[model samples]
Target: MATVKVTDLAHQDAQKMLSIINNQMPQLINQLNSTGQQMSDPNNWDGPLAQKFRGEVWPQAKADLEKMKNSLAQLQQSVQKILTNISHAGGA
Candidate 1:
């Protein structure tokens, strides 16, 4: 049989990381939105490139940023899972 071991320190570290990520995600998303807004501003771009990037690239980048929440949630869930059974094994 195979076994996996997790520790209290690991749980604490995971919790810390999850907390940090949760806190930072909003700021990151805001920055992404700011960038997208800047890209869409006509003053920032003066050529056909604006039609290409603001119309296509910036929009896609913003969409991807929206999807990042789910990915971060999955990471938090994985860490929580590792911390789950650890409590029964003298872990926090």
Candidate 2:
């Protein structure tokens, strides 16, 4: 079995990150849509249950979405850095 070089590993990591980002985007969109729908329903504001559910669930969901977004952004940056390093290494 051949040992993979660091550059090969980095390239694979970048592809994996891109795949994760692509998968998460649709989930993020769905979350946004669901949140919007929940807010748009007039009855959602009329009851204690709704208030409690929103208070407990919405913030967590928002936080999760933010976390995922940040993670995706960081992964993208890392991928870009890896690609740049690979290019520079090849040129050198």
- The lDDT values for all models are 0.79, 0.68
Off by over 4 Å in 2: 1-4, 7-9, 22-48
| Model 1 per-residue lDDT tens digits across residues 1-92 | 86767776787987788776778877888887897888789898758988888789888888888788778888878867766666656676
Give the clash count for each candidate: 0, 0
> 13-82, model 2: which lDDT tens digit per residue?
6667777776767586677958755774657664776676567766677677778777777877877777
Candidate with top TM-score is 1
Task: Give every collision pair in model 1.
Answer: none
| TM-score, predicted candidate 1 vs. hidden true structure | 0.71
Model 2 scores what on Cα lDDT? 0.68
